[model samples]
Target: MAAPAGDNVQLTDGEERAISSYFGFDCLYDHQRKVISDTLLSKDVFLSTKTSSGKSLCYQSIPVVYQHRQLPVIVLVISPLLSIMEEQVHLLRAMGFTATVIGKDPKENNDIKTGKYSFLYTNPETVLKDDEWREVLMTEVYRKTVRLIVVDEAHTVTQWGTSSTEEVFREWFGRLGELRSLLPGIPMLAITATATNINRRKIKQKLCMMNSIDYTESPDRNNISLFVSEIPHAKPLEEVFGWLVTAAKQNSCPRTVVFCKSIGDTAKVYGMFVRELAGCHREIVNMYHSCTLPNIKEKIRANMNDIDGSLQILICTNAAGMGVDFKGVQSVVNYGPPQELDTLIQQLGRAGRDGSQSLHILFYKNNK
Candidate 1:
């Protein structure tokens, strides 16, 4: 959903009630209402706003509206991470919406073809490469009933498009535009929290959304306070992290996520905490990166989403912090100044998502 590209961006009485009742909100924000209205007209939308700003509701409400009118419509959501798809599908089911990931849920495959799910969540790879998914998209049922295609964390289309790392590790991100021909004439809703003018241009080009309606909001979270400090690397390790170590000892450290630049840094930091905390490291901390096992990553995700879970501190690279909404991360620590501004904004945006007062502390080392 986004700003109106055409006239008459108004929601019908039934549509408005469907949105508010299902999401349990008194009223929709101005941007939200504008997005939902524009989307109803089947307009492309690029929504760039801060995290926790109800971006999910923008696209989620579309199928809700169609369902209310007794229309059999499905929204295809192409997300970056499987964890993100799984997490959102779970929440959607809890909210009484029919949504499911295509793969990994073998039992749901038949249901998906029957158009039982209002939303189908899958990665770009499956969208571009999977033969079975290709056949499903070609079916008369999908072509007639699939009204919209959503690209979540859409900034990655641009971020990965020009990166050499993608060529070696995963090239499916850069090729997301191919979905356009597969699902011709269907509008796309691209949502992200960390795209600038340059990034937006690239994303639009990558997704072939040159005429997409734009809904830009100030990327500000009022409850988050930011501070940057220089770390004297010459000092002993104990002197640098001793404060957190002590806080961990008292079991008073707030739920925190430490963003390191490299997987090795995550491991090093995770080891330090484990060593200082004695035998309780397993109960207090964990590390995540691209190399982490799938089951372990799922477990870590579960723990992070549980406010009362034993694992509290997470040290990881860029892998774990993308689009999933962790339960309550009160503190965000960037181990070093990220080379890119969007990365910094995204990492810090993870805080205050639960609406609690949060802190973003970045520690950098001098080059000289």
Candidate 2:
């Protein structure tokens, strides 16, 4: 592990060169470069960079340089949502990396045990539940194989409150000591796109990761336009109706994602799609959320990918936005405001992944 020289905290020449080569970029955003170099020195880092700002590169680069001259059994990425895990695996595989998903894709369980992958992404809850996986993870094979443990969406673990089940909280509630006993001196990295002051402290305490540093990139997107509408006793359905009408009349064909705040809201939005869009209005659209059956959700996701303009309007909740990609989605309609600004940003981020002009509109009503 290398240390930052002198009082200057800038990346060393070697670190800069390595990052540039791996990501095919001239330089890391100041935040990304710092986190990467700091983690390379074996320091645990907690960061709040925006989605698609290259936070994954922090750990992705770490394994390349700090694997101790041995192939890491795998880099374990603990993500909170299935959408994010699925999206990450897709992105990593596209990059020509040997990334395997443990929680999803059951067939890959055997592959994980064979230690054939460079990265294994799973949720913390899943990691703790299966004693069999835990046993292997505690073994020398895993010790030599895993170079770093990454906690993506680390804020969720703390802000959502700790689970009573040990398996779910094992990684957070002081169980790291036991695991560290087996694989002594392995580094941990906790990454999030948003963390309040309290969330930051809870993350360090829960993960038992000391000497932690935080990196936050400004949440400003010059290309993105933001609008917030505050209404009193606002009917969310009516909001969606107006947004769709306005969008449909726009000069350009812009895809839109309508985000509801709850499952019940999702039902209403889905119904609105069928009644307002598909039935009376004759609009082509689809709906998705966790409450939807798995098969149904799959069909919706597949439908959204139709490049020939088969699927145009997507009505969903936060459940569908995590890592799912809907290319050329130019607009995101928030039927109801998100609980937090960070979540709002993540949901809005799905629209602009293609770097095109994206629009985020929030509709909120003050019941009081």
Candidate 3:
């Protein structure tokens, strides 16, 4: 498959392409075209698609047409992981497109001026901390320039809807409503790879979307296999550690990922891997839970991307799973069952991405 066209992907009618050149393809994948067409027609769209299924391209194409019209297109993508947002910014910049991330650096007191960025990536926490971001978007300078707002990982906002911070949720909800009101008839696109039906409904209502169309493809990747095993209920940590050692021996330098349910579990798995397997391989094996300091987190993400080997295992909590692309990850070991199937599916999707036969395993201590 050829690389997707640069930001130069042509726009037709000064709005969208004739369903061909914009996507750099002779034709749109049945689902891809559906989303692109619906969004251009001023409809709110929710899409759940498989890994590597061109979800980003759907919303991304909107900016091209909007940009061509000199409408000053701005796409707001809400993602939870700071690392993921940074990675996206890097890609966009590499492609010679203007992208920006607000609230990541407190020192960046630069003007929140509208039209400065074509695509903006941010998290809910980032938005909550910086109320000025919303104000900027609501201002007259921004309203006339901005054409669309995209909510990536739309599920996170749904979780926030019923969170303990009622005031904050109300504020966010109101702001989103105000955004819609401010940019009436401007298209909004919420894209996620995994979402429950209830959460999906909440997202539409909370985001103040009307006549929203939902598009989804299963997260399950059948090319990857699943295995589950139960051990003594005690020492689930020890059980996971032992399994990692064995899995390391099975393949030749396989890139593996071990996902735990919480920050504490991420710590436990990392301790076991470091203490037990340190100095065993030339390839670096690292930990990636959320509690790590910001500087350390940046370093860990950088190292993981540069490292190559089957023995490289990134032990972390659910934080690393969503939209953080890892190429050639050959195995995904769940230290225990995740709280939900969507999580399990997302974590496993990271594996076998290179189309190699990958392994997915779940290990738990047996109670019997």
Q: Best lDDT goes to which candidate? A: 1
Residues 1-368 of candidate 1 have per-residue lDDT tens digits of 22122223356877788789888888888888888887777778999989888888988887777776677888899988887888899988998889899877788889888888899999888868898987888777777778778999887886765575436345787888888887777788999998889889888898999899999877888899999988886765566678777888888988889999998888888888888888765588889998999999999999888878787789999888798677788889998877668888999988888789999999888767
Comparison by lDDT, 1 against 2, better one: 1
Off by over 4 Å in 2: 1-23, 66-73, 103-111, 163-183, 232-240, 249-253, 279-283, 299-309, 354-356
Mind giving the per-residue lDDT tens digits that candidate 3 earns over 30-142? 78777766765666788888777878877666666665654566677776677778888897777656787876565553544646777778765455446677566566655
In order of appearance, the predictions have TM-scores of 0.92, 0.80, 0.83
Looking at model 3, residue 42 earns an lDDT score of 61
The C-alpha local distance difference test score for the whole of candidate 3 amounts to 0.68
lDDT of each: 0.83, 0.68, 0.68
Q: Compared with the true structure, what per-residue lDDT tens digits does model 2 show for residues 1-368?
A: 22212212334777577657876988777777777667655567788777668777887775455333333436788776766676677778887678977846678777787777888887655666667777767766666667668887776666454655444433443343244554456667888767767767876887777677877766666667999887667555656376575445452347778898988877777776566554434445777877778777766776666555556677787778665667677788887788667678778877776677888888877779
Best by TM-score: 1
